[model samples]
Target: MHGRLAKSFKMFVLVALCMSLTLGVLSGLAMAQEKKVIRCFVQAYTPRERMEADRWDPPQYYWKLEQEYEKLHPDIDIQFLKPIVGEYEAWFVTQMTGGTAPEILWRQLGAAKADYVKDWYLDFTPYLEKPNPYVEGNDYWKDIFIPAVSESAVAPDGKTYVLGVDIVGVGIYYNKNMFAEAGVTIPSTWKEFMDIQEKIESAGCTPTSFPLGGAMSNPGSWSVRLLQDMMLDSKMMEIKTGVKGAKGVVKRTREQGGSISWMELVRAIKLGIYSAKDPQWQEQWKLLKEWSRYWQKGFLAAEDTDAYRLYITGKAGMLYDGSWQVKPTEVDSLREFDFGLFNFPKVTEESSPYATGIECPSIGGAGCAAGNFCVPLVVKERGLADETIDWLMFVTAPQNLIPLCNDLGSFAPALKVTEGVDPRLLPFIKQLERGSERIQPDLSILTPQYYQQHYRILQQYIGGRLTMDEATDKLQREMEKGADTLIDQHPEWGLKK
Candidate 1:
């Protein structure tokens, strides 16, 4: 009887042990299932404080999307990693080459698309044709975006690799109180513009804030547009449209249509249709020199943020920045006075190429694809491509996007929002919508070496280190060298005659 009882106890212990092992194995499997993680590398879209606050409350746009996505797929997690603004390009490139790149990446400004699109980014053209599960009905995801937005991201190879979220327009932001106190109106011509600068300066405030300390400085592009607007004429327009010749002589075939192309700019350079030696070109340099005097003291040494701070604090009368400034200047920063926006004034016909006055706001320094994103090829290699693309589509839907646009205040949505935008941004939006006869591409789009040389000489010229003649000569050399390189790189562009 004792032997039988001992055998029964041993059997019971074995059964309990078996049950414990089974439970432990099941728990391990469940935890493994929950550990899925998706990584993203993006630029800072909202203020730092907002991101911190989001940890506790209902999340902001990015955070909200992340949280909702995680909730829907409880087994997966999303991580957004933001690199330092100045180091982002280098960091992204390194990560990509190392095969550790994040699944999603914000496209860097001035990054050569040809350099990475083929190897690093996944072509979304196939996915874009299909319907987005997040959007209503069976509408193609690409169809919802403004046509220009999608068109801007198309590569030379005709594949759409990047997606832009916002449209940015560059302009001047002015302190209304300073203008009123100085008795100056928004100038409509170059002469009046300079005169107002003097008046604002005489009133004991800096006329404007122009930062020249770095390659990414705002003044470099803004001033370039100003020069282009001042110097645009029939001859210039003709060359931009692929017509080439000396001063009064011009030539074009029916094959050379009226539209502007980068090739046209290159051909003009090669043929000397547009030359730094032109009298008008010299006049542009003179205008730049005169304009430099109105910039806040030490502007050449000051950072872009420093210039912005001076403007908002009333120490500067006008701020030359993009529509993106609206949020930071009006919403985030402290300001003692009302502010308004106005375009760079038109140059007189004597200074312009066209008999009709130049457009008030030049449109083309930056455009619809300012905030673009792309999925890295690594995402597909790692088997996360579908998940990553789906999340991007979800975040860009109207319901998700409109709130973020309201928060940003500076950019117009690439997607058409049936819901109204923030009322405060409408004025700036209207300014951007107004057309111009000529819109020059941002000079930064030039080859890096050329853009660097151009801006470096510009900084020297503006800082009194180089004379107008010296600056123009250096610029011409750099422009020719850049054109040569581009022609060699893309012979199909037909930049050469």
Candidate 2:
């Protein structure tokens, strides 16, 4: 009987060992599966409110990214969590400070500029030289992407924390068909542009159309478009620094660049950039008045989409929108009419060799680091971060860009003619290339403290808070205090020497 009991005990031990091994294998597999799935909070871009579709899903653009990437990487499944959209600064402070931030996520650019505009996000420096395997060292991208684009996306310290996925070049859109209707030619200089605007207005059509609701066409965007044209020839910023006609670029009223401030507008380019009694101060104010007079009575209150609708439906003659504005219309009635374009004409005697572009295209109508996704250095996983980088390279590959353009008529990659693109857009892209393609940063680029102050200055200029002189002078003081280092890091730009 004792021998029989011993045999049973041995059998029990064997069975228990087998079960333990089985459970161990299963647990390992489960952990591996968990690791393979990447959970990222794509801080919601296509606001649920703004979606052009009836569905509650994320934008087709994000789905399009996931579908293609999954085909290449079948082993990994990406789950995108959508964060609610609200005031980015407040939300970021709550989420990040609250310690519930996503493991993998896009840094809110507006919030980043407002709060943590520093090195905390993520650095893709080591990744760029060894960019995504599919597009590492792609010659087309290297050539097609202008240096200024990198200038805008990268901090002066040489780290890429953001990207401009779709570039915005604010050019003049005159209907060749409309010019034919009006019997006027496209202007070549700022002077000629004013004359053209006057003529277009005289013809009883809206000369230029834009909107300034909450923050759309405020002082920064409006000022830069004109400033981009002005800084090309003679600059008045030198008056602040005691220098001559300013050279190179200057942000925040040019005085930051050692360029004179409060100086008289050069007489030569009076038509394009200097129409007021004072070019430095009154120029912007005068232009705003001119813009106000040229637009419809209720234009200042129009939504951006409404503004575009006005232009597309033949109600407005000239529309000054960035490149994204030129696109496939959602409404069928608006898509038929063909629009023509020209870069805003030079305001100086000699047009800038490098004409700056006003590029802040929508990533769902608010600030998104659209073309940018940062991978923190501390992600520490060997292959996961690379996987994300590789995927980014795949989607933004110049070849892949054709589908994005065709799928939604959304963005025009700065290429002449990639396969499957509508030939009609080729000339427009070429014209954008001809225009100075510098990336123009908005007030967000300055210290967060300056946002209200800057807006106030613009309001003062527009709503008469300060005369142009008072506004410009006030701007110089605020800029010197806020963004001197950030702007000065790139010297030879006409800032304090």
Candidate 3:
């Protein structure tokens, strides 16, 4: 009878212990549910399924940063949302219209910049002025970035919206084995660059996979801007007219390399200071036409991917691309020969009589950094604004940014004190340092609409559908139209009359 009693008591004790443990688990889960979830719709540096699929060297720095941030603020939960597959702007607008946009958004600068400027995105100027607690001796958050990078975050209204985390540098990537076999060295001048292309073509290889045609006009547009900027460098000071009657406008010296404001560019166009009929402008296009012979046949219709494939397949001697291609090129198993990169050869008097011989301004500016993310106004509505800024500050801190960029093997950290930059990116860093400022008249600085129009016109000119005089006349008219559009949009510019 005593033994029976003992067994019954033991069973009762087991039931009590199980109930206690179950209650404890339920309590823990309830606490976890209370955490404020921050959803990040990020790009380029996202820690997505790529982490799981890559067998070697999964980029875990972003994950690590999240874990560390969560540990520091246990009440906050950071979640990175997967990228939307198509038309991100449309989806973003839909989500925002329904008041359900994520806390952090990526690539808010392109077509959506104009729309989002109407309070869809939070202005980061106030936060950028504050000290970032994550970085040592960082009294001001804005001081940590390269000046050009920090300046890039500012919108037309002079309010900063995005925080860029990395810098992009462009170079001409060449198959080292092919270059050696052709007995050609990296060219220093535009003339020599073309000469080498001819030699490479003579060696039975396509000179370059320089794609000029695509729905995405960036590939063609980028080279044109660089060449135009170089050819017209002597006239930049005349064109970079900051907002008329604005105070504290720092006039750039003739040799200074930097960007001009859209207002300044519009004003320049309206004043006829940046006319397409300018000989320098005409020469830039002529030189591009001259070089088109070395590009792959049907180059005008080739997409960016087509150019990349041509280079990777060893049929093309060189690939014109940015630093972002490093990791993919390194890992591409199909590329049997080693590859090297060099900056676009500078245009000199030998190439164009209008060449100022001033170094071509750096193409890889603040825009190259894909980490230019912005917080939605919805995040503020959800009372998570401060937390989101804190998270951004932590991620952008030089200590964290360096490793993140290095792990990706692309782009240099855009911090003032970045250390341990990837060796592969050293050449790009040199390029950035070589040209501290970009020149104008940059159609891109105006608007996506005008830039697209300009690129299309350029394609027509290069394809022999239009004469140089006809093209320049059309281009000048487009500039005038662009200026008129801006003037109408912003009556506040006080120049509408």
Model 2: per-residue Cα lDDT over 1-497, one tens digit each: 99999999999999999999999999988866764555565442332334575322333465666777788887767676666567755764565555454445565333443333443455655655553455545544434454434433445445566544443334566566666666778877655667766887787777766665455563236445455334432342342233455465434321111122111222122222322233443444455554456666565466577767777777777776654544533333554566677655555433333324332211111123233344543344334666665665676676665555444443454333366765544444444333331223434434556656666566556654477777767866665545454445434444441
Model 3, which residues run further than 4 Å from truth? Answer: 1-22, 50-58, 108-117, 241-259, 436-443
Q: On a 0 to 100 scale, what is the lDDT of residue 464 in model 3?
A: 90
Candidate 3 per-residue lDDT over residues 1-497, each given as its tens digit: 99999999999999999999999999999999999999887677777545554533645578899999999999999998875889876887788778888898875343334554567778888988899999988888888887766655556566766666677778889999989999999998998999999999998988988777865545466677778777766666677753333333233321113356556667777776777887766877888888888888988898877888899889899988888888778887678888988877789898788886766556655544567687878788789999999999999888898898888777888776756887887676666655534544243456557777788888899889999999999988877887888888777776641
Candidate 1 TM-score, true structure as reference: 0.84
Clashes of each: 4, 15, 3
Error of 2 at 316 (Å): 1.8
* Candidate 1 vs 2: which has more TM-score: 1
Total clashes in model 2, counting residue pairs 3 or more apart in sequence or in different chains: 15
Best by TM-score: 3
Query: Largest lDDT belongs to which candidate?
Result: 3
Sorted on lDDT, best first, the list reads 3, 1, 2
Please provide TM-scores, in order, for all candidate models, with all chains considered together: 0.84, 0.67, 0.87
What is the lDDT, from 0 to 100, of the residue 52 in candidate 1? 54
Task: Give the runs in model 1 whose Cα sits over 4 Å from its true position.
Answer: 1-36, 46-59, 109-112, 116-118, 245-259, 350-356, 360-370, 435-445, 493-497
